[model samples]
Target: MKHREYGVVQRVDHHGRTAIVNWYRTYTSTDEPVPQLLYESEMSVYDLKDHPDFQYRPGTVVIRVANFTGEDANCTAGQ
Candidate 1:
């Protein structure tokens, strides 16, 4: 992957700094926890490397977080 700058602060905040993106993740499971105060910062960023159409991007390797069967996951895991 190529190098690019990213932010640690949420996009909707009044103040923001482009901090090193330590990592990226997505959780479709209802078991995951999200505090009430954290609802604003979940904005998306665009990445031309993956999406040529310039869709709303979260800057993460896209994992099919929903509706993928277990066998599909195992196959990708082997790659």
Candidate 2:
């Protein structure tokens, strides 16, 4: 599976076991289009915060989506 690496977490939704993560997608290639999505996953805020690749800080926008786990391919967030 292939996953694009460009996004920022706009918000975190915790209504159930899965979280609806609002994110702003980014593109590396100029030809690529930017995608804004609300990805739903089982990952928690603490999980993201503890991620080695993801530097989760207050007001810290995600500029890249690190493809560490292949599970990321199953995650999708969009209007």
Local distance difference test, each candidate: 0.36, 0.47
TM-scores, all models, native as reference: 0.20, 0.30
Error of 1 at 48 (Å): 9.2
lDDT of 2 by residue, 2-24 (tens): 25442344456666433444444
Model 1 alpha-carbon drift over 4 Å, by segment:
1-19, 34-79
Q: TM-score winner among the candidates?
A: 2
Clashes of each: 0, 4
lDDT per residue (tens digit) for residues 1-79 in model 1: 2232222333433254222222333344656532123122343333212433324547656544444454663454325
